[model samples]
Target chain A: MKANEVPQDKSSLDSINQKELCYATDESGNYITTKSSGWTPKTIALNNAIEDIKERAEEAKQRVLNNETSPIEYYMELNRMDVTILAGYVGIWPFRVKRHFNPKRFKKLSDKLLQKYADAFNISLKQLKQGDLNED
Target chain B: MKIDFKHHQSAHCENGVVSNLMKHNGLNISEPMIFGIGSGLIYCYIPFLKVNHGPAVTYRVMPGLIFKRFAKRIGVTFKREKFKSVAKAKQRLDENLKNNNPVGLQVGIYHLLYLPDHYRFHFNAHNIVVYGKEGNNYLVSDPVIETVATLDEKQMEKARFAKGPFAPNGQIYYPISFPKESDIPYKEAIVKGIKQTCRDMLAPIPIVGVKGIRMVAKLIKKWPKKKGIKVANHYLGQIVRMQEEIGTGGGGFRYIFAAFLQESSAILNNEKLMELSKEMTVIGDLWRDFALEASRLYKNRKATTGSYDKVSEMLFELADKEEVFFKTLKKAIK
Candidate 1:
């Protein structure tokens, strides 16, 4: 909480192109604005969250390769979504979506259903079927 | 059609947008001051209300209220609208920009391109300013980001219409007229802001204010036995996320409140407020410690259930300190 504790070295703060500015009091109790140094404890906590999501995405991707689930499942994981959320976006029942997680069932989905999934994930049907995970 | 708007990054969205908008309208005010005057601090934990499949725990008031309250207190007239159609919303925003008026918008964070992937969630109360339009992109000033950024028009429309809890229905606001800076009453506004904050912190509601902190402490203490370690840890993780990750300006909003207190001290020439500000900073540090301890328990799988008890005890102590702090603050201003 001391001013010195806030890393004065600009390079440490620039690890990421963090645009958010934090307003905190200095050692002399003067308020000043500064960018996050990425080394801050809060930043570390945020990094942990990002890492957890990435790990989930990776696990979901491996499941797709093994044919244990459909590509929709992988996209759901990549978007930090659960069946309830994905179903909400696609306007379907969670139970029905669970059935569609099977690759066979997903392949048989109507264009309407597939289009809904693609729209919810913000991707094209081609990309959805092919398991494209790249950011748009 | 770029309006001459200066964007400054802020610790939180609503306060940042309000501060920037006020500055653009020729009224200069610090973000913390705006936050305080608007009575933005809050503590609410609802077990039934689920956000992203967890109990809803919020550290501040609902979005857009701060802008409303600050404007009211400062005697600034402003216009607010929420369009039923996205196309209509886009047209209005474009017209405002064409006329050189910077407009404030409330959009979901999930679709914002400038945010880091990790930070984007389904949170729909994020605030930003659309100051101009350049071809297919809208030049935006999002307070959480370091600099002004641009968003594709189609993407901005989608973000505006994002569905979920607190979905912004293409909401936009802008100041129409502001009172002269010299005519504003700083001391009176600061006093009123302080009193309202004290009331919010000390209110007797079990699910909000100081009592809400106690309720969370109680839940943390019993979570492992009732919900099991996995569920308890998940809930604790959510708490840390609300406190540290969701643009809380650190320690929930305690740090920002402390900064407000420091400014109040200088304006009122009260050394006691300065002392209280430092004390509040210490309290903020304790909250940070609580977050660190909770996160440590979450990361370590081998951690025993007793670790949950330790964190709960810390919360109880924090609640006690804050209770006394607010009580003293209420009397100090009188």
Candidate 2:
């Protein structure tokens, strides 16, 4: 890619005030590091990934509202943590993490364990216990 | 206390850290040179490995190998450590700072409070340089960022000890000594680096190098039929992310390698390398073309039916181009 040909499309990276460093050849074919605000292809891919995360969180929230799953599931999706990643952060096994998604099992979780979950999600213990997603 | 570390931004982290550290230690090495001599460029499609529920597609060699290889090639030695205890990690880092040494750290991108929300993920292989500490905050030189950023003690601990595959476990490394510049064998290292890359790309393994790109092309053709649209799209997005994300510098290190070849031509005084460098740039553009189409397909923007096949065809072309490119490079260097 030529230095002048580097894309400057607006995307989430711009909204967050971050510009990526890209390497492109100058007019003479000498490589140069140019600051690119964004590129269309990269922007689309990132936005698509973010949208997928939002859609997953929305589904998890609906399940929580119906009492089919616990709010932990909602918060986990909201925090962009899958069961495996959330379990990794909470320092627990994957199966046990999935068990906590059950509403019944979740209610019986101890304060210490809830704190771990809260810490993993970077939320307070009260927030986890209340099961409130707040924009509801 | 902080060493006089002058931050020079680069397109990728490891190269940035290595280049910046080398500069600080009285040696000036361009990021592309460091990346090339390290033989950091690679393409591997691991079907069995799943990150974010999609097959792992990596554009570069494994993390840390680039720096390790580069240091060994240039006869520089570095002290490295990974701590199990967060407290011990903190103490060691502070000790290094007190001794006026800036150290490179491997930390998770997630929970790095200073970064924009969109960039943070659960991936644990991100690298940074902690130059000094001021009060509770550590001054960090993250290579991808425009300027130096800061991370507080609480946030730093979380990032350092982040658990997952490739978890850093509070890793810290810094060059202990550098060989005299005149003693370093630039021509020999470049020759070795190019040859190793040629061997890697032309290897007969089905899931590595140029063959790996073809394998992914085959898999892409089957994705929509097998995994459904949503998942197939997600997997496609993952590929683009891995290719264009902060570490790969752009076009999956293609541009850097192109620049490296150009630089190598001058040092070795070989005209063939210069011609090949231009060819590599064209190859980089080809990768961009593939990414553009693949992203458009996933974004559902004017993509027709069977667009997966379209992108897969592009990958096949890339495989062909790279196969020929590496073969030519092998002969040029030899």
Candidate 3:
């Protein structure tokens, strides 16, 4: 099935969108208060995509942990893929400093980038050096 | 005490050792803080040229045992600025020597880092010594050997240490102004470079994924509990500050990682993991634009903390996406 074609729960996705900010709920996600009975094709579809990315990232990360590739190279590859997805968010709106720099989302992006590197390298940010050795 | 060697123009003598010739003269030598750490070179000044002697002057190349190649790069030139305005240095030299009563000529000591061959780095000391002056043409001492080992006798012999009361090449006339306590300008430059380089490496950026998540988990767990949140907070600040200072996106992250790895867990704590990761993500998203903005601004105006509002927006987006994606997992666990 195509990515967007996959079914998802419209109400669940909408519930999150309605919130001013995603992390605003802190420990509880928006749907946490809802009953667990709300399983739908749309929900499943979104979960699958999320799972796919997670799995792909995991496999790639394992290769790095196993010493197959460098962290920088891997991140670049992810950026290449994500850039297409991110283009709309970045390029769709009128050009403005505020629109361009979404501090909350930027933090997530930064964390994701670092997470990719650290995962692939099997290291903490603290442990990584300019040339940390990894086994392939 | 000025020893000038006349060699063919084509013959390359070690300037590292040649710098010592200034010491043969009455000038006091001060240790070079920067150049002394690795292989060192001797820089010398010649007052006159001898027709029979090969070159007008020569330089001594003192290579450190570990970094021999660096020792070979030291070269000699006629630049007068290399000498602390002789009259000024002389006055200080005279006063210091009067109290210390050095054995011989006073020379300036310098520390230099050089790369002679591929993949090899070296550090050594450079000093100024005088040789001889004849009719406006002073026969200055020159570096005869290419590289020397260490201050020890065995290494000294390998570098062809000549027999003399002076330390290997020449004796310290007056206590060379060692950089130990004085506010020497060159020392400050070297220290700045070293500190900056290290600081740049230790800042943070973001990485994503399960393995990354797992690693962070491991890190958080392993992080020492004794230290307050300050340790983690320091790394977080380092990441942000370095991005601001280096203006090269997230250049400081590697150094931060290096420090984290190098230091004992007793110093780092769990709070650092969450704080650092959060900060890293925020900075990474904005790094490219931020760096560009910083580049456009005057060096003085480029505040490190530029546009936190934008960073805040990015963080919220990330939180939303993560919440959307991870809610299921958290719910299932709940």
Candidate 4:
């Protein structure tokens, strides 16, 4: 795409503070090095990813409020994790973790399992059980 | 204990780190030039390997290969180590910094505190330089960021020990000896780099290089029928992310390679290379077009204005263009 046709999303452009240098060919096909104002397509991809994560976190919060799943499930989604990754972190089988997604099963989880989860998430057991969503 | 290291931002991590490290050792080379000499560009799609739950599509070679290849090509000796213990790794890094040596590190992006939250992912191949240490934070020169940043001790350790595919394992590297700038055979290295890149693009491997592009195009054609619209779109998005999001210099390293050609043209005093460089920029634009269209399909979700076939055809055209370009480049450089 032509440089003029490059996306000019001001909000995303303003998000970058560092003013990194980038190399690009000018309109006359001359190579030039210029400070990036963050109009690159990569910035747009990053914005999309952030929006997706936020939406997932919001949906996960709703799921926890409705008691459709346990807080563990909510935290997993908040961390951008699936059952496979959470299981790997917690040293449990993915199938078992899927079962733990049910509030009834999560409540019955032993202290050992809860501690494992807390450690995996770098949080305390109390915080894990309470489902605190605050970033540390 | 700060070392006098100048950090220059780059389009890709490894290339940037390599370029900056070389310059710090008194060898001035542009990031794209290092990328070209290292033969960093590549195209591969693996169905079984998954990144973010979609098939893995990579635009460059694996991490550390660039540094390794570039150093070897220029006869520079370097040292690389992977620690079994984080504390040992920290000690070594500190020792290097104390001696005024800037050290390169392979760390996971997720735990890199300096990156914006939106940009952090589980990618573990991210490269940075740790040049000094304060009370509790290490002075970091992350090549992608605007300025040199700092990472706390705990966060640095976390990033170094981040577990997953391609974990860093506290990997660190630094130059042991530097060759004089006059010792580098720039023209010969440029020719070899160009030839190797051509081979990569024209290789017969169906799952790699230009053929890999065609293979992915064919897979894109089949995705909707076999995996349904949502899954197909997800895979397509992953491909675009690999091309555009991941430090690919805005078109799967095409622009960077074009820039490399431009610099090499001047170095070798070859007008033919200058013309080839312009052609490369055009190819980079085409790749961007492919990314834009694929991203549109990914966002549509409804399959309204975009289709898998259309995206695949676009990729096929790109593959054809790249094939012709590489063939011509091989003859021109020879």
Candidate 5:
């Protein structure tokens, strides 16, 4: 990792024009800070993580459409959360959160509780209630 | 009101925040010096703990400890507060700003609107400095960014109280009292930092320090055979991101530590530390090479079990290098 050897792979991070500061060695093997657009390895890793999250969100949306679970499931996955994390955000117990994942339970959820879920996912009441994954 | 804070960009968030805040308080400590004095580098692979839906792998010490440890080592103390309510948190923050005080805050990155989407995630251990306020927005110095940024009240509140796994809980800290800068024991602190890091890396534990590196290498070896290729690749991605991603300065803080060592060598007038610094940089390079190979495997779906094995072999080498590196480091300082 020479100072000039710092990679500029132009990944998603670079798309925002924010270069991350990285430490590399100079010709004398002395350390120096160089701003890098991004590294190819990090970009690939991040892209794969994003792809997996999107895939999971799609699966959750399909399950909601089929009435296997509620729209909260779809939104939770969309927000990159699992049951435990979503529960933490909504300030609900994990057991109760899992119960809300059931379509029947979600349908009976009070507006107050539904609002909490909606807020945690940063979506509107209508969006959470409709539970539609299609881009609108 | 603004506190006249100077922001110096660094590879990592906590070190940058701590260093910048110290500078604001009239101390000129480099980011690597802060990282080194804090003993912020470590390798811990917790199998049971899951973050990002994969086994938790920490490349640094737990969040918030670096500042705490750094302050303690330098014989200074920070006024630390965490509020349960967002309103109280905002009030305290504004009070500090009104007094022309810049404070470092532990915040969640997910809801920080100023961050790029690619870097924003559910991580709650991110640190930033709030230096001033103007009308509706607060002036922020996120050291990873090249320039200053801003966050309105609503966005600031959300980031401060972001829940789930190491929640920030509206934590804010600022130095209240300090010895004269000359009395700040750099020599003793440097020795202690080096000794503690050596102790940590050489600890005879299964899942921490050098042994932790070995444990992860072994797990990587068995991952493809035990789990499917997809899951194993996901796990590998977790490790790589933790290492090379933003804030690490690449090589899981190894380069930063090496830089620290290089600086420490000049400070302590120890030729042995200078040689060790070079060795640490070489170890950091090995870690980067490992990441490059592993990332390529997951990037292309054509990766075979043999490829995972090769990556695992790379990890084994890293573990060996780190083992010898820490041992020699321990003796060098002694």
Candidate 6:
């Protein structure tokens, strides 16, 4: 049930097969195996916890979008949001130039994101450019 | 503070009006070597005279002067002619033949090759001369001779016959000289090429100001990926730094050398790589290292320093460690 409760020395534990971890039917009427066979128990638990956090963060992001009083404050808050929020859908890090990364797909998605925000903020692209260039 | 015109001009004009011009300019003219045959010629004064010992020819910085007159008359000749023994004359001739330009007579002690005791007369002219022993008697031959004949009975006994015709009088030599060029085409071509290339590459950026890193990064981004932009960035910094350090007197050749070395080191063979390495101290090695690092990080490849990374690092570590290599090079040049 807990990591500490597992055997401290794995050497004395008789491997059910030649492998220390293996697939086997348990007493419970369901498909079951040693956690280490396909994935560690710790990894599965961490992934679930991460998903829960991401969902909560996304809900908070939507609420902020719906009740935004100032756009400047909203954009700043949006910038603070990490990529992990929508990472479930993307399944990969955006803005990464990896060997396997499809640059065209990433660029199209980024453009769409920029367009949505540009229309929402009521800021012209020229004004944005001037602001960036004229920044202190 | 007055200009010495006499030191400047080797020859005077036929009308002597040049001296009047020199006086008007507050200059004096003298010294044959300094100004020889310069009258009526548009002489470009050589900023520096570099004598190449390899060919025994001097490269005058002023191309015009080299082509005009010095190219013909500049030659090497012996001081005097002396011969004590047969062997001495032969040795002297051997030395003269080896010289790029050999002429005139030089007097020195002579050692008889055949006869140890009796002294022989040696003359150095266009050839060498020896008038002493072949075997049991006296003989004489031209310095150019491969063989010598002993005087026969009639020749040895008779006084008139002993004076051999083959003996060199006062002439034996080789001439060291370069073919005169009416114009120095090579130098002109080099200068023209430099000006053209400089205009194309540097004309866009007119400021004699610092090339900050952000602008350099933008420039690097525009460069082709295959061109090793990181390496170029390092050198672009050094190039601008070199201009600021040395000023325009040195021009962009230093930067050109740096850029060429940076790009060439990546693909060049070991021999050529080492050859270029000598010309590029900090800029080359640093840019090369930067390229290698970028290749490793961005391209997922091994370091470009190859197996000799440790050695290259150690050699470049001196000025490169402190990042003052260009400055050090500027100091050395100054």
DockQ of each candidate relative to the true complex:
0.35, 0.63, 0.01, 0.36, 0.73, 0.00
Candidate 4 B-chain TM-score? 0.97
Off by over 4 Å in 5: A134-136, B249-252
| TM-score between model 4 and native | 0.89
Candidate achieving higher lDDT, 1 or 5: 5
Backbone steric clashes in candidate 6, count: 28
lDDT of candidate 6 at residue B87, scale 0 to 100: 50
For candidate 3 chain A, the 10 contiguous residues with the lowest summed lDDT are: A17-26
Give the alpha carbon lDDT tens digit for every residue of A1-136 in model 5. 7889888787776556688888889998998999888888998888888888889888888888888988887887778777787888899898998898899999888989899988897778887787666543
Best of the candidates, TM-score: 5
Candidate 3 TM-score, true structure as reference: 0.15
True A-B contacts kept by model 5 = 0.64
Per-residue lDDT over B154-250 for candidate 5, one digit per residue giving the tens place of the 0 to 100 score: 9999899898889889999999988898898999999989888888988899999889988888898888889988999999998888777686733
Model 1: residues with Cα > 4 Å off, grouped in runs = A7-16, A39-44, A51-74, A82-88, A91-110, A126-136, B249-252
The DockQ ranking, best first, is 5, 2, 4, 1, 3, 6
* Clash count for each candidate, listed in order shown: 2, 0, 117, 0, 0, 28
Error of 3 at B221 (Å): 41
The alpha-carbon lDDT assigned to residue B119 of candidate 4 equals: 60
TM-score-wise, the better of 1 and 3 is 1
Q: List the residue pairs that clash in candidate 1.
A: A13-A37, A19-B146
Candidate 2 Cα outliers beyond 4 Å, as residue runs: B247-252, B301-304
Once superposed on the true structure, which residue ranges of model 6 sit more than 4 Å away at CA? Answer: A1-136, B1-184, B195-214, B218-281, B300-334
**Regions of model 3 farther than 4 Å from truth:** A1-136, B1-285, B292-334
Q: What is the lDDT of candidate 2?
A: 0.86
lDDT (10s digit) by residue, model 3, range B1-334:
2223322110112222322322333322212211221222121222232211111111222322212221222211121211223344334433433443222221212111111111010111223222233333323222311222112222212112121111123222322333322333433332232233222222132222222222322332222243323232222232232232210113222222212212211123333333333343333334333333323221222223333333333434433443333333222212
lDDT of 6 at B195: 32
How well is each residue in B153-172 modelled by candidate 1, as lDDT tens digits?
88899788876667798999
Best by DockQ: 5
For candidate 1, the per-residue lDDT at B309 reads 90
Error at B252, model 4, angstroms: 6.0
